[model samples]
Target chain A: MKVAQILKTCTRRAVLAAGLALGSAVSATAEEVFVYNWADYFPPELFDKFTEETGIRVRLDVYQSNEELAAKLQAGGTGYDVIVPGDYMVQQLAQQGLLQEIDFKTLENFPNVEGPLKFPVFDPERLYSAPYLHGSTGISYDSEKVGELEESWSVFFDPDPALSGQIVALDDELEMYKAAAMYLDIDYCTEDPAEATRILELLEAQKPHLLMYSSGGSIERMAAREVPMHHHWANGPFRVREEAPSWRMLFPKEGVNLWADNFAIPVGAQNVEGAKAFINFMLEPENIAAATNFNGYANSIPASRDFIDESVVNDRGIYPGEDIETRYVGNRLCSVEARDLRNRVWTRVRS
Target chain B: MSNRSAHSYLAIGLPLLALAFLFFGPLLAILAASFTERAPNGGIDWSGPVFDAYTALFYTPDLFGELEPNRAFLSAFSRSLYLATCTTLICLVAAIPMAIYISRRSERTKTLLLLLITIPFWANLLARNYAWILILRANGLLDSALQSIWPGFEGTGLLYSETAILIGLVYSFLPFMVLPIFASAERFDWDLVSASRDLGASVSRTYGKVVLPLLTPGILAGSILVFIPSMGNFITPQLLGGGQDFMLGNLIALQFGASRNWAHGAAIAVGLMIGISLVLLCLRRLGPKGPHLSGGA
Candidate 1:
């Protein structure tokens, strides 16, 4: 068939699906929910499952980055019922009055969420958001390329000359500088000028070792052997391993950057009731497990442990032990000075 | 004469008014934005005027602090200039021959050639870039051809490189250069060259002194057409040069994209416009002076 014909058919199917979803949403009288979340964060089947169990139909939109989603919300272009933001962005959005206060009464499974997931610095007292997925930033490498992995951050930062032009680092400012701070055992979000200067020097030193800095699809490149090692989010590397198991992940002994994304209703949502129902439905153990399995990220709810595979739940990479936890630092929203320093440093690194 | 004059005014004035409202008006808004401050958290302040954005750009440290000290702004500007020059040169070289060939052809042949040149315009820019990717990637057709020609040849994956960027820019802007040059070449006077030859001048000298001067107008128009867009292009550099090979257009886009600093982006854009204007002014001053060949024809 011609490409035009294929496109026309695909568009027709999409329009039909949209019409059916709208019809169900209108008939149910349970408000229409519009969710904005990360690309491929939720299982496609879960939306259908929610519609089947509850009469509320959910329309989902996906964003590639937290900054992108935040920009859209700030512009007031997207009318999202629920938005998933990373831990740092949660505070930023709440401060901007973009998020709505969550009603605990509506969330039946709220208590089942782990204790560690609650009382995050970004959303203390759980007033605005609920934890969705948790993961860490760490080194993922081909075992064949870098034999017998040592947990030191030095392997990436000051690698042997042989490994030059074969390493990729995270493009994000917070993650890159935080990794530098971890190597020095200093505060990740330090306001001290001297500490900031030291971090910049360290990054400059590591520049020769890096092939490139990239945020999106760097892990995929790593799997393709374009680069042997990369600083990647936990889930991406794991997903790569499913395709090419020779690639392995290691949490640096110095520390790993932990992050959690949460689902919160935006302040101006038109479908608050439906949003609440969707959130409640997603928090259920089985559905959360489906999301975790599909995306290969650690589920936020402790109840999901029962539904997920024991192997995935027990894996040290996904659920790091207490020692790993001790080293892990959840990225905090930096002060204005620190944020500026980070942006400057990142600009330099990229330039 | 009065009716003809009024008709000409109406024909030109309406389009000029529309252009000023639609194009120049938004461009002025962009210029205004550059003078404003960026808010602490990414957005533009619009509250006060500040030069901090431009100043901050200069102070940003070099990549790896290697050769280029002021790397952020300077490197991007230099890269953009370099790419634009390369693209313009490539277009000039390729367009002259093709335009000459077409101009010398019969009217039917010329029309067919023009139609053929425009066939690629049916495809989207993104699709054309993607098609280049398919041809240029590792293990792609280019690589395969090279490997077959020379045994044990390890192909350089040239898809995301400066060379690839030049190829894309040249391909996209070739027609702009060709159309104008063809217009001038088509009006070439065979009598002048014959007269020069008959006066005992060499073939090369007669062609150079007679044929070259007549093509100057087309060359100027085509250069301006290709150079303007090539300097400000973001997609060609972004897709073909990789993220590491930063360009002025990419930096401007970043100010709008991840940085959320629209004012800075606007400032960069305004700077680019000024740069283009200066180049055009220099060309006009330095260009050759000759009588209009078309008037005699």
Candidate 2:
């Protein structure tokens, strides 16, 4: 009985000590900033560079989509210092009071932003978010396999019999619908159910030819030449070209999706100062250029072009010419009725 | 005795409260949300007690603003049921002989065989599924093997097909079927088989009348274990079947995902739960009346 009593007292004291240690560990966040971003968006070395330049340490986490990021923030107490949101999500998150209003104009390198991207529709005054990387969605194919096909969405939507079961499109509903609408030359986010039916007909017709509706692992898929023709984003083709030089990224005659992911500070961030410092650090031409070189995506700073690799900067797919620039269609948040109608259409197509 | 009775109440009460908080709490929340309305920008709207989500499952407002019978969710549901049934039946057929063989082995050999059967589980399911993709894709392992013998073979035509999805589902759930039947087979009386044969019963009659009836409880439990999860699985279909062959699990997930309709997702989940419960109830009534027939593995 005496030994058991002593053992019980010892365990109780050990538990108290462990609990105290964990409490202190959690509270010891004087120099770390937690960033939530898309997977493979930023290089790991950049965080090390930030830590070397500034005294702040960096902790990073990744998410798959903006919806997941927004949902996490909405649940509250995320403890994220920085978050990367896509174009429309920036506005939605801001309106929902999930983001903090950080004045980017006060940052030293804020003026380096390109004039066109500076006042984006998502954040007009640029008080909440800053553009990180921008890209467009289009068709990617191997020249060796398909032999220089015409640059049109029809090649994918109405594929040749020989090219059947050799195509892939993004799994996202909104982006796919937008591409179809662009191909059909109809307005997107329309309340008209007939327009949605038109999109569904096009999707259902193309489903037989599609190998899959997946967005992840496009770089590896393209590099391996697993699928001859892939509906992909701009950056993926650039990486694919590094392995297979014969690959071509085509900006279809129909308008393509032009999107930018932005950096913003979420509410309840523990390290606001660190987050602001990291944002300002990323704004420099040389730093953002290094990111573009690694991820194969273009940065918003126009002057970063000089620091970018010659192949990437000169490639029309990554940096399109003036004629193709006008065909960029930015994503818009759809109305409730339109969204429901599209959801029903999407169900029908997939079913 | 009174003091011991107080201790018993404490033991049971604490566990029951924990179960209520951890299990039934979320279940009740999902049931309640199924009756609510979806807000414009997603999330649940607490202001409504509507049945629109349930009704929307069978009917849709067409482009002409008229009500039409919607076959989308129903088709996906039927496809899921078909796949789950196929998976359960295939697992059952493949596991019976294997289980009997293992049960007849020596104790040490039985342990090793059981370990080997469970080896696939050490790797993550996602990684295993992706490995299947590499082995089944065009110019992959299967294609290359066939090409060595028949140079005309260009593609396997297995990846992103219904057959590929079935292979994946069977591979994933086969172990669930094996372990349960093995348990029953281990407990089975071999002397009864000997006696029946000595009493002039034929081979089929002896095995059928003696063996199968004893294995029914385990077989029923195994079917439940494999079927319920297979009905709700989206990963195997998404990875192997290319997301083209839609299933009920994927449909429910889409509502919460790109569709941004939580009420519909919750309603579908509630409906699935009810359906599964009814199935279990029916199985319990029809199954033999001795063993507990608990589901696991």
Candidate 3:
């Protein structure tokens, strides 16, 4: 009886100690800047480095897509310090007044940003959103498997019988829809019902050959030789280079979609000062270059180019020249009607 | 009330209260949302109740008089039902023997076997699904093994197929089916089993007449456990079948995410709930007249 009573007392004390420790830990983390971003979009070590430099610790949450980020914010009271949004999403958020204007004067590295990125159509004034990384959707393939394929988008749309069950397109409604519309020589964002019908018909025709619907994962799949050809993003070659050096990405003769991911402080961000410091830290040349190296995407910091890998710099797929740039089209904020129609069609395609 | 009566009330009342708060409270909220119109950009429309979303579940009723059938919705619903039936059937085939074998084992061996069944649960479901992808992709382990065996055989790996999806569903839900049936098997009257065998009955007749009636409650419980989740599952199909084989879960996810139609999503969710209840009612009607057990997995 005496031993059991003593053991119970010890257990009670241990529980109290643990509860106190957990309470303090929660309070300690409350001082941190909470950054919400895309999954695998940055090296996690960067946050540790930031904490090492600054007194403030950083907390991270990741999301898979911009739609998810938007939905979370729209739901209200997200408690996020900073969020990353793609260009079209930024436009939507800014229009809704869900974003805060960034004070560029506080950041010493603001001038290091490229002139083109500073003038994105979403935030033309560059007040609400800061550019992070940019890339374009195109074709990436295992050269070992695919040989002498056509340079046109038809290679993916109307694929060779040999390439059937080996091709993948982005599962995203807009990206693949744009690719299909561009391949048909129709406007990428046309409102015409006939063009929409044509796009749906095109998607249906291509459905049998596609191995999967995916936004990313093509690089690893290519490395694994699970997929021979992918209607994928330009940044994929850089990612797959180390693992599968034979993998190559190309700009199709048909136009490709250009996209930029940017940083935005939501309206109710609790740690504006910490968020600004974090953003400034990320904009620094070495830090931005580190992000680019880790993610295999192009950073907006122009001065960071000197620190980029030689292969990434040399690859035409990663940094397309003027010829390819002229062919790239960016998406605008889509009307709900058009979005709904496309979703309905996509549902049909998948089902 | 007297202390004995009060204690009995406390025993039942606490669990009922928890059930009401945890399950029915949120279900009611979703039910309310299903009646409201969807806001312009995916939020709830608080203006008023609207039955339009519920009607839209089966028909467009738009400018175009295309009321023949909502092909997308119908296909997704039918596929979900088909997949669920397949998963339940497969689980029944696999779990019945597993449960029986485990029940007949020595206590220590039975514990070990049960532990082995539960071992898969220790690993995360998503991680397990990803591991499946590695084993089943092109030139993956299965393909290579086949290639080595038959030099002329061209190997087609099973990723992004109905077969892969079924494998995932069966592998994940088999344990659920096993546990409940094992409980039922534990209480199985051995004397009756022997008498039926000795009586002029064949093996099949012995099972049908003597064993099956008692196993009905367990079989129903296990089927319910396997079928419901499989019917609404998207992850197994998404990762293993590459989101190519869409199901009810994918359709619901689309309504909430891509389609941005929360009202429609909620309506579909509620509709699925009703469908499940109806299915349970039908099953009960077909069930044998016996002492029904309330064991759930």
Candidate 4:
């Protein structure tokens, strides 16, 4: 009985010691900056750079889709210090009071930000968000598959029986409906239920021609020659073209949709200063260049363009020409009526 | 003995109660939400009880749009049912011989065979699916082998087809069928078959009348286990069938994911549950009447 008591006392001391050590470790690592960003958006090397410079441990999480990131922030489970939301979502989040207004003076390389990004529609005075990456959504096709370029969206949405099951379109409802609206020359943000019905009709007419609906990875399918043409995001096709030269990213004569992803601090962040520091660090020319090259997406940092290859910086696909720019529409968070119309159209499309 | 029995009941009941509270409570919440209108800002509106979500089910006009014909919840439901039935049939055909072979093995060999059947379960399902892709893709091993054997052979590109999805389903669920069939077959009386044969009964007739009846329990158990999950699976259809082969699970997932329509998703889920329950009821009604027949049979 005495021997057992002695052993139990020793075990108790060990457990207490272990508990104390763990408590101290938790306290020591309490001040951490949590960032949620798009998958492959950041260069892995930057994590090391940020940590080395700031001495503040940065915990990074990744999301595959903008909707997923928004849902996470909206649900209020993730205590993320920083988040990268797309242009329209940034406005939505800011309006919802989910984001903190950013102080521009704190950003040392703020002057180097490009003119296009300086006063974006989402953040007119650059209050809440700083532009990270921008791209366009358009048709991507195999040049070798179809001899001459098909400039119009009608190529994929051809009502002809011959083109049945030869084309693919984006699975995203908003983008798909918007493309239909643009093709029909209607207001992209139409609140009319009739317009939604018309868009649905157009989609249904195009249904027989479509092989499949895909998002994000549609370009890879096109590169593999699984589908002849696809409605794809600009950067995706560009990334694929690096491997498959025959693949071409096209700005449809109808119009292209422009989108930008921006970095912002969430409202209830524990390490707000650390988040600001990380954002500033990312805006550095070399850092942004590395990130842009890694993701194959256009960076909004003008100073970063100087560091990037001239070919990429000047590429009409990445940086649209004036004529192409005139045709492109920056997506904005629609009013409730438009949002309802979008959902209704999307439901009809998916249904 | 009575005290011990009461203690055992308490032990089991307490955990079950806790589990019910934790799991069923949330499920009930979701079910309640499905009956209400969704708020404009993507939340439960909770204004008043309404059947709008259910009415949304018959809104077939949306079917014509960019959405694929087979991607709607109804079509997906039908597809899942068809796929599950096909999977169950395939499992039944494949497992019978394998289970028979396993049951007839020596004690040591039976253990080894059972272990071999279970070894694949150790690997992640995603990894196994990827492995199938590697073997089945156009530039994959099967294509390369075919190309070498016949120089002019053309590729079928079957990896992302319905055939591939069915193959994946059967492969994954085959073991579930096999284990129970093996259990039934191992306990079967070999002397009955011998007696039937000795009485001038043909091998096929004797097996059909004797062995088949005995194996019904295993067959029923295996089919139910395989069919239930296969009917609700999203991953198998997504990875193997690709986007073209949308299933009910995929549609329900989309409602929760991109669509953010939890009420609609819940309504669909409730519909699926009702369908499953009806199927179970039908199965029960058709079950063998005699106590001589096992519960699973």
Best by lDDT: 2
In terms of TM-score, which candidate is stronger, 3 or 4? 3
On TM-score, the stronger of 2 and 4 is 2
Model 4 chain A weakest lDDT span, ten residues long: A1-10
lDDT digits (tens) for residues A146-248 of candidate 2: 9767778899899888899879887888778889989999887888878888998999999988988876656667888888888888766678666877778
Worst 10 residues of 3 chain A by lDDT: A1-10
Native-to-model Cα distance after best TM-score fit, residue A331 in candidate 3, in Å = 2.2
- Which is the better candidate, 1 or 4, if ranked by lDDT? 1
Could you tell me how far off, in angstroms, the CA of residue B32 lies in candidate 3 after the best superposition?
2.1
Off by over 4 Å in 3: A1-32, A48-57, A102-108, B1-18, B61-68, B289-297
TM-score of each: 0.85, 0.91, 0.89, 0.86
How does candidate 1 fare on TM-score?
0.85
Q: Considering chain A alone, report the TM-score of candidate 3 relative to the true chain A.
A: 0.86
Which window of 10 residues has the lowest lDDT sum in candidate 1 chain B? B60-69
Docking model 1 quality class: acceptable
Report how far off residue B286 is in candidate 1 (Å): 3.6
Q: How do the residues B166-221 of candidate 3 rate in per-residue lDDT, one tens digit apiece?
A: 99999889998999888888788878888988888898898888777777778888
lDDT of 1 by residue, A1-351 (tens): 012223344554476468657667567665467888876567767887887788667777766678878888887957889899999888888888888988543478887677566678778778888878888988888878778868889888888677886677776667889999999887877767677778888998887677556665464465566667888877655666666667777888898898999989898898887888888887889889988887677876877888887667766567777777776778678887677666666666656
Q: Rank the candidates by lDDT, best first.
A: 2, 3, 1, 4
Write the number of the candidate with greater lDDT, choosing between 2 and 3.
2
- Model 2, residue B189: distance off in Å is 1.2
Question: Model 1, DockQ value?
Answer: 0.30
Error of 2 at A95 (Å): 2.6
